[model samples]
Target chain A: MGPDETAGHYLVANVPRARRGQTVAEVLSQLIAHAHDCMDVVCVLDDDERLVGVLTLAALFALERDRRLGDAVQPGFPKVHATTDQERVASLALHHAISAIPVVDAKGKLLGVVPSAALMHILRREHVEDLHRFAGIARETTLAREAIEAPPLRRLRHRLPWLLLGLAGSMLATLIMSRFEGALAIDPAIAFFVPGLVYLADAIGTQTEAVAVRGLSLSHARMRTIIGGEARTGVLIGLVMGGLTFPAVWLVFGSVHLAVAVAVALVVAGGIATTVGLVLPWLLGRFGSDPAYGSGPMSTIIQDLLTLLTYFVVVSLIVG
Target chain B: MGPDETAGHYLVANVPRARRGQTVAEVLSQLIAHAHDCMDVVCVLDDDERLVGVLTLAALFALERDRRLGDAVQPGFPKVHATTDQERVASLALHHAISAIPVVDAKGKLLGVVPSAALMHILRREHVEDLHRFAGIARETTLAREAIEAPPLRRLRHRLPWLLLGLAGSMLATLIMSRFEGALAIDPAIAFFVPGLVYLADAIGTQTEAVAVRGLSLSHARMRTIIGGEARTGVLIGLVMGGLTFPAVWLVFGSVHLAVAVAVALVVAGGIATTVGLVLPWLLGRFGSDPAYGSGPMSTIIQDLLTLLTYFVVVSLIVG
Candidate 1:
């Protein structure tokens, strides 16, 4: 482990603890006197100051006063090395349905507990951060209130970097569209569906990015399962949307080829959009940057280029 | 005053309450003997069961053994009616940076305390729900794990409704393009920037929607202040993007008029996108729906049609 990996920094060192021989009443009195504001569970320590077991205060409160504190100890509570990350801590708490997570040292000695309040704060902050990053805002402040109230200059500074990348992507999109100039020359109606096709594909991808950004981090589901599920859903959304649009376009434009080209493009674009959305985030997460960093503006531009390519190719294939 | 407005539904009614004159030691023992899982704050009640004051277990623990329980009570803690929404309760907990919030009856009698665990759960649930709604997923399950693992069919059902709306919008987009058949006939180069323009506009509007959806709900900042700030930011983004795109487009397409048309359209589209993004969510929230509902797929289609209108209007005026 690196020097920066210590979990001691995030641990609340003021947790309540008791020796094994203490009576329930005695332990309760001592715990109440020594514990911090978030003292939900009491840790049991041995003579060597090593953590042995733990129990919730609620369970202790329900016990008979004369009972030994050791008798009330709940076995098999999970403890983490002091070097564990806050995400791990929060996940553990959620998994165990426990309010507090115990932090320990190399000797199995109790360091402290990461309190419920801190866990809750970590979860909420991460939630807000993910949302902000997905929106392509660099986030001038951690608090949503502050982010919302930031001056226009600060807001621009925070938001411009992504849109700048978007600017570069938009230029690429222009180049790609120009490459399809022959198709436009062949059938001008081909150019009509460009914005709509790209918009729908971008929208579909954004939804997938939204799901994958948080879903990748928090869900225990296999990546294959998620990708497969989203891809199929994407295909389904495409079929219904395309199936309806096929007749509508034919009726409106009186061109069966144009209609067929659009329906085929929608189906192809939908599948690609979902795959790109899910993959970009998963890849970012694997590389240790936030998964959300790869979503929203980033994925939109990528999906737009792909959707355009798909539309132009299908139009050439069918309309020619 | 309705009979159904009982605070019991949201209340953790198992909280320990104390009378005024008990010693710190006596109260600690009594509280432990009587309290439930969420016993962080001990409520103090008067003779008629009216809420008087509150103190955390930590505060009580630090009090001298001989001190009276009344002396340990923290004054001016916020209380809410039982019928309050969970969002309000969660917000209150976050605002105060406290783990638990007390609930009271119409007559100011103590009902129960909302614990830190419950607060954490509420915030997490709302966070997940907001993300799911933003993605246009109906969310068959509240759990991220469940949502990720849901059958493709169920996922399709949840996601297709929004895409259906998007389909209708696309047809509208197609019709809008058909209206501009003469413009395409004039110079096919005008059609080259359509996908790029719509994508960038949608991206800009999405960022605004992301900010407004959460910002409006959490920030106590005035709505006009937020709107004004966002509008300025939008115009600035437009000017920068438009300024850069003008020279690039003119260089690439060798058509000064087409480049000028695209640049003007970008600036106009940027401002309109931000205004619509901010206003749509605000309006939806005002009508008592989740503000997030106004974002994602619904707003993407709206932004697309608007961008198409702005682009065509500028192109026709410039190239005619």
Candidate 2:
């Protein structure tokens, strides 16, 4: 994890702590004598100051005054290393149904706990960051308020890089369209479906991206299983949409050949789009970048390029 | 709020409640005698069973044994009505830097407090829902895991409604393109810019939608101010992108008229896209639907229709 994005940065060292040998009353007195930033969980340490167990305040409260902390503490509790990513920390807290997560070192020595407030803040920040990245914003603006309220020029700076990259991609798209110039001149109606085909492919791809961005990180399913399911789902969606469009196009344009081309292209583009959407994020995650970065303009352009090629290929075969 | 989405649905009523006359020692004894689901804060009530104040457990623990609850309680603590939206409830907790939020009825009688666990879960769930809605998913699947793991046919069912809507929109795009057949026949090169222009416009509009989705709900600024800033930002983004495209199109196509038409169309499309992106979500929010529903396929299709019209208009005027 980056230095700023680690559990160490979020952990508070001044949380309630106690030795396992201490009695419940003794630990309570010690807690009363000191001011701590987080009191949700008390860390129990051994003679080497290594964490052995954790005791929730409620659990501690329920214990008899004479009960030893060692007997009351719950061993095998969930904890994290200081180098753990902040998102993992928040996830652990959520999974364990605890508000605070304890951070330890390699030797199991107690460091501090990431407080409830910081956990909530981390979750909120990550949510905003993911949204911005999915929309192709350049940097993490940290807050939705700042993202919207920033001066126009500042907003422009954050938004322009992706659009410029998209412009370059658009040039490639133009090159692709130019290759089909022969086909377009043969039948002017061919150009009519370009925007619609590209838009539908992009729309279908985005749904896969929305599911994969966070899902890949959290899901335990193997890549093969997930990819297979997505590919089938994509084809099924394409079939339904294509089936609906075939009659409409044939009736409107009075051409069975053109309708068949468009419908076939839609099915192939759908399969390609869903595959790309799932694979790109999985690849990014493998490469240690954010999976969310795999969506937005980059993947949309890729899907567009493929869809354009698919439509022209299908058109060449069927409309000929 | 809907019945399932209200604060009352998530609140825990069996929590530690104290009368104003109880001393710190008495409250502590009472707490020990009973088990409460949420112990983060103690609610202090009045004679009419109306909530008057709240005291955090840390503060309660810090106080003298003889201190009365009335003297220690903090009035005007942040809270929510039982009918408050769950999103609003979570936002209130984040705003107040509190782990739990008290819920009350119209008479100010305590309903319960939404605990920290519920708050975290709600935030995570809302994040997934917004992502899905922004991608035009038909229904809220609640979990990203569920979204990806559902059976192919089931997944198609969840994802098809919007794609079908997009298909209808695509027909409109085709009709618009058919009208421009005269322009396309005049110069085959005109069709090359369709995909690129439609793409750049969609990319720019998505940025605004990303900013506006959560920003509209959280922002304190008036609609007029937000809209004005977004308009300038949109046009500014357009000018930069259009300026870069002008020379490239001119040099590549060797038609200054075509380049100028494309660039001018780009600028106009940019302005329209940003305005539509921001305004659509604002309108949706005003109409009480999720602001995120204004994005994805719905807004993209709208932006595409306008861009297609803009490009054709500019071509008919300049490239004529």
Best by lDDT: 2
- Candidate 1, A1-320: lDDT as tens digits: 23332455568787788888888888876776464755667888988989988777677787888888777787888788877866667777777767788888899999888777777777777677667788788844456766677887787788889888988888888888888888787778888888779878987887788777767777777888888888888888788888988998898778999899889889988888988898888887788776777477788788889888888877777767
Lowest summed lDDT window (length 10), candidate 1 chain B: B1-10
Identify the runs in model 2 with alpha carbons over 4 angstroms from their true place: A21-26, A64-68, B21-23, B64-67
Cα lDDT tens digits, model 2, B172-289, are: 9899999999888878899999989888878888888878888888999989999999889988998998899899999999999889888888888888888899999888878888
Candidate 1: pairs in clash = A7-A82, B7-B82
Q: CAPRI verdict on model 1?
A: medium
**lDDT (0-100) at residue A170 of candidate 2?**
95
DockQ of each: 0.65, 0.72
- Chain A TM-score of model 1 comes to 0.90
- Per-residue lDDT of model 1, residues B30-145, tens digit only: 87657475666788887888888887666777789888867667677778888887777777776666767889889998888877777777777767767777777774545666
**TM-score of every candidate:** 0.94, 0.96
